[model samples]
Target chain A: MKSTLDSKNLPILLPVLAFSLVLMIWELMVRVGCWSTDVFPEPLRVIISMGELISDGTLFKHVISSLFRVTIGFYLAIALGIPLGMLLGRREIVKHLFNPVIQFLRPISPLAWIPLSMLWFGIGDKPAVFLIFLSSFFPLVVSTTAAVISINPVFFQVAANFNFNRLEVITKIIIPAILPSIFTALRISLGIAWLVVVAAEMIAVKSGLGYLILDSRNALRMDYVIDGMIVIGAIGLFIDFFMKRLGRIDSVFWASATR
Target chain B: MGHIVIENLRKEYSNRRHFSRSPGSNPAEYREIIRVLDDINLEFEDGEMVSILGPSGCGKSTLLRIIAGFDKATSGSIRIDQKEVKGPSPNHIFVFQHSALLPWMTVRQNVGLGLRNIEDKARMEEKIKEYIEMVELGGFEHHYPYQLSGGMQRRAELARAIAANPDVLFMDEPFTGLDFLTHMRSREETVNVHEYIGKTILFVTHDIDDALIMGDRIVVLGGKPSRVKMERTLHFPRPRDFEKYPELGKLRSEVFLMLGVPYAV
Candidate 1:
């Protein structure tokens, strides 16, 4: 009973202690250095500002808006990327045709597309969501393609011997075989989407956590800026946790279980 | 109806060797064509269990794949039930040396894969259970391939193949990696399944003992460019006790001799 309790509590306890230590150090530094609230707000002041933002419903609005963009953009990337990746993975000619273009587009930062995005999609949520989509899409495609390509060829040979049609081969053999890798890609691309949405929002939109940070900075409210940053970090952690849970689903348990 | 006929079957793999040379050096040598199977002609009677025995790299697997319609022969034809073998069909199933059970699927799902086209769901479920029980994997229906032991994985794969209800089953060294006891048990189970279902089976293996134990007809293939070195029909009765029968010992020695391996009685 003691060992189980220790094991269960250790993970949550360690991180909590580390975070408290950091907050204590930050509070000490602010007091010792006598830094102005404009430059470096106290950790307690940031917490109070967070509570105020939460109470006023502004935090909910910003978080919900950002989440909405990520959900639509990331899922859109998935919808387009997985099938394209499957096609490119299976067909050498198609891969050869599109590979150079994909590689060229892959390394460019999604932020670099902001000017063009603003021009194409204009301001507000459209441009920000488009940027998030662009951020997630390339990684999803690359990872999905690699996943499909790396599947055991024996599986395909087995499918052939079983006389699986094209659809059956894809649905039964290809998709399931590549699902674990695809989930890895999903997690990675979701993180990228989350990161890019902040930058996208900072420039192209006016109502997300990124915008809140900018708005608070312009108004000389460092505590509110820190509050926004904390919210973003917390939400990012939640998203990653959700994805890790998704990777543990029963169908793809074989791949992750061994890991 | 599942009798297989192969005539003049040949497979050649061309290896193109790339040579890096200085400006004044000689040009690269021409590509070498290695013949894996040469002029292989064979026949399998309906419901017959035939073992194609060969040493490593002697084209035994190539021959099996060709017969199973997974690989193309350079110069001949294979016919099943008087129809030309064009490509892979649902009527025949090939079990590889490695278990081909999809790692993502459970044992039940893997077996159910073969029964996808069967419209009657109840029959499909019943067949899946029956085959799973046949391979003695009744309790492991929900276990994935990676979760099972090597022997169990092999049994699950056998169940998967048998559940397909194929007209012919081509097994390429299916029990090569199991422990001695597991191998013996699996071989017994294979023979039992063969007797029960009576599906035409082509078992490929490098082990002379495996061939002698399981096959009704043993085809020994060997040499650099492999061909049928010898073919012998075993008329021994069912459940032939190899340990007790002197005739079985003689047959074992004969097969070993054909394989060019020295043996002692």
Candidate 2:
């Protein structure tokens, strides 16, 4: 009876317990150390700051802007990456020609492109979106290529035996075969895109959670900085949850379930 | 004419050894040409279920694949209905040893994939339903390949191959990896389907019992670079009971002996 009760309530109870324990420790540290609210604002102060930001519409504006940049950048990455990856995956000669360049670009950080993005697209939404796109594209391409390459050769043989044309093979077999792995890649690349957007906003653009954090920090509003961080973390978690649901759809059920 | 003719078929693979002779050093060696199928000649009349019986790695599957046009012979030619077999065609389908049912597709979809070119939606749907029911997967029509058991997966593949209405069906150990009961049931189902539709079947198997049970004619293959060792025609009628027939038991022993499995008299 006790074990069943524990199992039933644990999901909700544990997180709440852990959160309260952290808050208690934080309050204790502040009391013991006599730290100033300017250096480290307490949880209540952060909550109040969050309320002020929400009431004034600052939080929503920043969040919407960040979301918009990520959306545009991510879709662009998907559009360019998947087809190119499929082409390179199928053609050995093309892969061999471009593989080294892809590898070289893959390792370079998205932050490394910020200066160039600023020079090309200027200090606005364009530069931030460009950085997010660059950040997401490489991982997307690499994963899509791997997914295509790893598809069972038997599928192709079966396709051939059925006398499928090139278009039929691509649409029916290749696309479905690569979808599960590509969805996993989508999750990872979107997370990276989100991370890059924040960094890009901090430097390249003027309005996002990252900009809020930097702006609040410069003005010595530690509560607003902490609030910005909480918002960033919450949004990231939500995006990941959404992607997970997308991967669970019936068409790619076999691939995701195996993993 | 659905007759198949395989003439002097040969397949040689060059096995190049790439091993390290010294620590962390790559070593190069001369390539060795290994003949998997050496000068194989076989013929199958229309509507005949011929079993290519052999030991593992005896090129039985290789020959079946060559005829299906999934693989090319190094020399010689395969002809079906007086036409040269150059590539895979919808007229013939090969059922792989491992179930090749597309994991993403439901049983119905997998079975109907080959029939996508059929213009009549009602006709296509009817064929799909018919094959699914024939394979005893009617209720599980919407289940994915992974959701089914090993036996069901094999049945789904069989349904897929048969639904195509091929002139020839090349099956490479289609019933391997099933439980004993499931194996027997599936074998009976295979025979029933053959009787109903009457497609020419070229089945490859190492099991003497499978050969005896399913084949109208058993072609035994042996030797290092495999060739047809012997051919025997079973005169028994459909659904032959080997347990009741002493003649079949004697033939089974003879086939085992030909496969190099000695039996004490």
Candidate 3:
């Protein structure tokens, strides 16, 4: 029990210690007049601004809006990309037809789509969500296709020997076989999606944390900008933690553990 | 009714080394066919356990795969019970050399893979339980393949193969990776199971003793572009010992010599 507590406490304790050190350095720099207070506000000032946004509900509203866009976009991408990826993985002809096109599009940044997205969707959450979808779609497709292709040929032989029907092959053999890789892909694509959501919100939407960061900077409320930065970082960390928890499920345990 | 016939079977793979490694530098040498099995012919009677042995990479596995309909021969046919084999079917199951149990599935679920068409739920469960008990993997039914020891994993695979009720079962070096004691136990269990079920099993192995002890008929293949070097029926009774049958010892020594080994060791 004591050892377990020590292990758990280390993760939290070390981060807290580093955080306090950073805060101390920031406050010290401000006191030493590294820059003017207006441009680079003290850490305490940012904390006060964080509390202010929390009580006034602006931070909560922005967080929900950002998360809402990410959810709709990420889900839509997976809903379409995963099936298409499975098809490409299975059929050589389909891969030959679609692979070049996807490879061409994958390297183009989502930020490059901002002007066109705004023109097409005309502001609001639509463009931002579309950007998030575009950012996540290609990586997910590539990862899923690779995952499916790497499934052991032995399992396919097993499937054939048992006379598994087309539907049964997909449901029993392909899906479960690639599930661990799919989880890894999701964690990566979700990170990509989170990154794209911020850049997307900066240009296409009005209420997300990105907009809060940009709007505060324009008004020279550096404290509010810092608060937005901290919130985005915290939320990113939370999302990563959640995905990691999902990976510990019993079905996945077999793949991850050496046992 | 699992009698199998291989007629003038030939397997050749062109050396991809030139193209893949050099990338079109040696265009003329690309179609150079390296034959693995040359004009091979064999017959396996119904319900007979035949163990095939060879020098390593003598196409014992290739031959097994061809007979099981997992791969194609360049110019030949494999007929099982008078039907020409085209592809893998439910009538025959291949127990892979490695544990091919789907890692995500529990022992019960992996075994249940072959029992999918059973309409009665209770009957399906009963059958799964029966096979699990057959391999003495009773309590491990709920455990994943990863959680089990190597011996247990092989037993679970054995249970799965028998549960399928195939007419012919193909095992490609099924005892390749086990420890000595585990390998012995697994081999013993396999013989007992074969005796009880009386299914035709095509077993491929590198171990000469395994072929001699387990097979009703032992067939040895050797040399490059291998063909059957020796084929004989073991008429010696059950629990065959080299000491009890002097001929078994001579035969074992002969196989070792044929494979270019100076002594039995």
Q: Candidate 1: misplaced stretches above 4 Å?
A: A1-5, B20-28
Best by lDDT: 3
Cα lDDT, model 1, residue B168: 96
* Model 2 Cα lDDT, one tens digit per residue, A79-126: 999998998899999899988899999999999998888899988999
Worst 10 residues of 1 chain B by lDDT: B20-29
True contacts kept of 3: 0.92
TM-score, candidate number 1: 0.96
Ranking by DockQ: 2, 3, 1
Cα-based lDDT at residue A181, candidate 1: 89
Give me candidate 2's TM-score against the actual structure: 0.96
Fnat per candidate? 0.89, 0.86, 0.92
Better of 2 and 3 by lDDT: 3
- Candidate 1 residue A182 Cα shift, in angstroms, is 0.9
- lDDT by residue (A208-231, candidate 3, tens digit) is 999999999899999999999899
Instruction: Chain B TM-score per candidate, please.
Output: 0.93, 0.93, 0.96
Candidate lDDT scores, in order, read: 0.89, 0.89, 0.91
TM-scores of the models, in the given order? 0.96, 0.96, 0.95
For each candidate, what's the DockQ? 0.75, 0.79, 0.77
User: What C-alpha lDDT, on a 0 to 100 scale, does residue A79 get in candidate 1?
Assistant: 92
